[model samples]
Target: MSMKSTVPSAQPDQFVHDHLPPPEQWPELRFDRPELEMPAQVNAVQALFQRAQQAGHAGRPLLRSDERTLSYAQAQSEVNRIANVLTVDLGLVPGNRVLLRGGNSVAMALAWLATVQAGLVAVATMPLLRAKELAAIIAKAQPAAALCDVKLQDELKAALAADAATAGLKLLVFNTGGAEVPHSLEKMAARQCEHSTPCPTAATDIALLAFTSGTTGTPKAAVHTHRDVLAACETWPRHVLRATPDDIVMGSPPLAFTFGLGGLLVFPMWAGASVYFPSIPYTPEAMVQLIGRVGATICYTAPTFYRQMAAFAQQHGIGKLRISVSAGEGLPDATRQLWKQATGLEMLDGIGATEMFHIFISSPPESVRRGAIGRVVPGYEARVVGEDGQELPRGQVGKLAVIGPTGCKYLDEPRQTQYVKAGWNYPGDAFSQDADGYFFYQARTDDMIITAGYNVAGPEVEAALLQHPAVAECGVVGRPDDERGQVVLAYVVLKPGEAAGAPLVKALQDHVKQTLAPYKYPRDVVFVSQLPRTETGKLQRFALRQQAMQTPSRNPTT
Candidate 1:
């Protein structure tokens, strides 16, 4: 689509784009490091762990217990045993998709890797998923069977039986207690390992079926190929993170989301570093404790998580986390500053969508701008286009569009066109570029709350309120107002010792006013126990908006 503009001179020439990086800064592979390439064979499972057999058997991959450590040899043997049963006994085929439900554990990791190796698409999900949500996902993506931990299997079975759509699906329970199962994964593994050759699949073959967090609407599946998944392991650690093999990586995003998959699985494995996966409840305090216990060097999390971590770090001490990154949601400036002060590490803000599979724009540690989402990565193109489909000038806010090899194709959904335009994909985010070519996140174009004639992004007000010490968590949304068309309303969760009343409400309102333009301050404040979140830990602002609409008089009177 050709766009006309007052911005002809604004678009940098392709030559300018090419020369932006110094020749010396170009990626150089270490002689001893494995080559990073999109494999000629496209199978996702094979592309990632193709070397696991040799690596696993030669020396066991490191596994940490609650108090002890397990060797790499032990891990691979267990994973290989599971793979054999999945392929030989269950007749799990290359094309079949298997749903995996469990928290982070050695078994969950083995199940995911084995499913991929056996040529099955792994649909890993959060253990906290409610029955209703699980029913919707199961109906949308009918799996051949489910592999669940025994503890959670009863609830999963009940949820499956309660939903007519998932009745015929088979279930295989794996007791995480390390005991033998007669017909379970361990039992199947005791049989002969498969000697059959794997059917070669292309790099573009779908390896994973990851669902969106569904903070706003029904979750859509983001299909990722073996190549796309491997590309993240290859590109991100070098381009965005630059972590060494010795770095101990840890973070709090669930593995089901690509955010977690990249940090907790791919990045650490590619670097030959150890990744610590905490299976317990992840409060900010617990995260700080984990880092201290593990001597973690790289930490990945959302901006909200960063703020809480920073708060704990200020009161206590955050261990030596040399590299910290934030994505899954926008990083507020306050959180960024707090983390920097606490950890002495710049918090790299990344912007990625489920459709893209992983982060495409993020700050490299050395080149971070205080309030930007960094530059586009190599092999990707990003642009801001106006309503008329013309490219917008730097410093002008417009729809952010992107085109890359890993761009999205929704699973049989008509609204795919709504997010994909002329081969570019956009998840409805509005962004602006500065003259220096840094992208600044604005509101989602559809989510901009227009009050009178002013356009207010809900995130902007929420970020402002979060800067206050008394605020624990908050959501800002537009509530219908007869005279003003829409008024800003804030749902706030106060800190543990903070009181909830008109005084606190007024202080929050005044706090936002002091932090930002007065027009963006919340006119109404409702104290709540907690803000709603989707399974993937993203805030549910749309749900809060609905709640605000339902309770007309719930807004506190100042």
Candidate 2:
């Protein structure tokens, strides 16, 4: 399976292009839609910069911190300088991978944008990733250079020392607090020109390798291109988000995740909007305070964060906040209602995957429904399909299948078959569609709890449990049972000052039974201080299931 290219790539290093999955393995990319059309030569970062200028926002705020703001003109100048530093100072060519390790800050965003602008593939790692995790990514991606925040360099330094593949990595540090340190990106950039030529990359050339956060198992890098990134902006932002230039965006998802990459950075740039980077990692109280302090218009984070921020937002005020986005996990109806009650703004919920780049299915803020994640985004087609790839009835739960401008393209992994099949991406989400085309999330395809021949969705049960005042967070999984096979079990974190005892457990069970079918109620409840979650804030049900394995259910017959 060979691909014949019509557009010439500017990439000098051919490593990424050579290692791409076979032509047949790529989920079919559709660019037939008028909005999806683009020039053969495209650099996503350059396009974003151009978009801001065309929208008459060159002098407007583009990046913000608590104490400072960078106008679009200033930001573009810095980005160009960094691109020059990457290609000139580091002696790297287009298509070389540059590993980026930082949080959601102006420095991290500039490094990522500059890497892509230079035609280099940016492999951005999570800020909180440990030495072992960093070592695994280094071994897999084998980046030729790294641009890391000085504050978070210890773990990466430890990882580089232990991994043979990092021996050749040329490292530069950013956010040095003006220290004249050697190998400082800021120092190199200052000596470089304030302008650099945008790499003449093909629209099809790789832009970034977004590795899955490894919530389920081993991390897999999902490949996206310049065309793919721009096309997604046309679909989700143009159709659903509709961000204006005046909007100031803030979020908790690290830029390493595509969710943050799009919501907090790319989409904002496309809309000629600015993004705020909190001076510190956001706690619920801090996030609420900063949103008001910065007058953030749109905010993005997981549903759990929304649930935690609701009380703080109600007390301190959400400021100029207009749009609240919930993703990374299913938005429980309880959290949705609670936030709406607190902020009077409907949460703009969406369902997307790292493989797809960004949200492909989300309702416009105007047409939000209680349980639905909205209709398929424009430029894409979606269906609810069964095991045999046949479309299931409108009301029945089935695997969610989607095909659009962007789809799954793993980096030489056998699991490619498991993600992309027959030209569609099965993002491992189970969903049911209504006659009106609205889709309701069931759970992760693997998160469905089977109890006594009846299937239960964990999110549905968690949503019900969250309705109880004492319940804070919960993860539901299937526990092995002696009599009825697997039974539904819940690991719950109760609110502060709430007693966790048999009576509270009974009350929680009764609440679920009242909220849903009695059979779907948790047969066993384990109280814990907190549920296991990935950095992206997705519940780690596999860990919970393993924890369940260690403690048998005692064959509880409810």
Candidate 3:
């Protein structure tokens, strides 16, 4: 199969300019032409919600939960029910921040759509984020209200109550299974008249405020407008995924992650396609079963998940898989080979960020390069630059910077200046582009370990290890893993009486595994007296890297 471009490929000079304008002063670049065919619709939420309503009136659109399926009309009526409560009951305004804490379920989708359709900002967060992390995010976003799953309601209440800065944030739980929680969405919507007035919003208005980890200490909110969402839904589908209305897209990543949100929800709704959202967290075997049961044609997930799916499919064949897309982290060469061997489908590698709102560079089904992240999308621009900000020649690895319709707009955070500079956004990644225009991911400019498709900050893991009862101090770095590409490695200075041995190493590993995602657990743990540091007290991470290299591989056989 071959992919033919309708337009001439853009040149590297197209990405560089003598002067770059700030957001307000961006005077329509020469590239902004009618040729671009940007979607007339504004935000993804507004457009999709409106379509869902239209589908309901036509008696065609249907949404299914594990419990039941609702027609388009039924789902629209439910959105109205919740929107009315937010407007009339809670007195939330258009720009009010409403933090959504949940997973990839129909109820979560409904809540997100309802919040945006009501003209409020929806900040969706991962369910697995710890209390401290959530509190840090809450403090920054300063939500007027929080819509959380009942399962996490008690923990959230405790976390917020313990934090003095979150005193004014209100809580509303989803209470899925009729949990013993007050002020559930179910209870509130039932009390309402089952209809709420629609609050119209402009496409330029802020509809989504998604929180993503920053190079700095805490996570920062990336504010995106209705325009950004629609742009992502349209461009990504047309150029990369190339999904049709007949395609049933399925994946393992949670909706909180941008990859899942765009591919799973917006893409389907935009094309009038059917989507299947699993009620439970995705296991490889569970995903195989779902795909076979739903007859899903297109699947969107990370390279790690795809590899696991390949392993699962080998044992129990995936009947109707047409295309599988991989993103969220670098796609290793081995994973790509294994996936192709097992499924006979090329894993479309893409490199995206919360900053760009969705994928900017991805391999179209026909033009996939097995080990590369692929060329820039039709409507975006990308370049590799040196430290002094000069464009690096093709084939030379350098800092990867991006500028496109969907760029970063940090919400009230000064770090915005650090990320978005001179009209180009750098998400702290190192990459290179070949003469043929294929992009290859190198590593994070920061010391973040992308293991099993999760960004694990080396410092964050080091902080977690320091809390262990037997550990006096620790330094964490990522070591290369054959499967994960990188695994967290910890060098610890055990507390005086704690001897260095297998039991102590095992205990430290167990402690970190319990503290964070088990995948981020330190595979190599070395007990030491002290870590080498400079006069200013920066732990010499390069030295730790050498120590990690001397340590044997801890990756399990694939």
- Tell me each candidate's TM-score: 0.88, 0.98, 0.75
What TM-score does structure 2 among the candidates reach? 0.98
Q: Which candidate leads in lDDT?
A: 2
Off by over 4 Å in 1: 1-37, 50-63, 67-74, 163-168, 179-182, 192-198, 553-558
RMSD of 3: 11.4
**lDDT (tens digit, per residue) of candidate 2 on 64-156:** 996678999999999999999999888899988999999888888899999999999999999889999999888877798999999989999
Model 1 lDDT, full chain set: 0.71
- Return whichever of 1 and 3 wins on TM-score: 1
Say which candidate scores most in TM-score. 2
Q: Assess each prediction's global lDDT (C-alpha) against the native.
A: 0.71, 0.90, 0.71
RMSD of each: 8.8, 1.7, 11.4
> Ten consecutive residues with minimal summed lDDT in candidate 1?
2-11
User: Which window of 10 residues has the lowest lDDT sum in candidate 2?
Assistant: 1-10
The digit string of per-residue lDDT tens for model 3 on 1-558 reads 111123321111111111122455321211252334444334455566576566543254445546776655677788888888787889887777788988777788788878877878788887777787777777766778899987877667777987887787778889467765678888888787866655555555667777763323456777776667776775667777777656777786666767777887777777666667777778888988888887888888765466557778887888898988887766666667778888787777787888778898988767977557899887777899988778899988788888766777777666777677677778777888998989877666666677888777675577567657676557778888788888788888876788887777777778878987777788877677787652212356667776777777543321
**Deviation of model 1 at 273, angstroms:** 1.8
Instruction: Write the candidate numbers in order of decreasing lDDT.
Output: 2, 1, 3
lDDT of the structure predicted as candidate 3: 0.71
lDDT score at residue 274, model 3, on the 0-100 scale: 65
Write one digit per residue (lDDT tens) for candidate 1, span 1-558: 111112112112122222222323211211112433454565554444444444442253444536344444455556667777777778766657788888766567778877766667778877888777777767766677789877777667777988777776767777545666544665666675634344465564567778888876778877666666776665556677876656777787877887887777766665556667675777899888888887888888887888878868776676777888888887888888888888777887788887777887887878888778898865566888987667898898899887654656565555666777655677688889998888888777766788887888888887888789898888888888887788888888888999898788788888888888888888888888988887656788778878978958555533
Give the poorly placed runs of model 2, Cα more than 4 Å off. 1-5, 554-556
lDDT of 3 at 390: 80
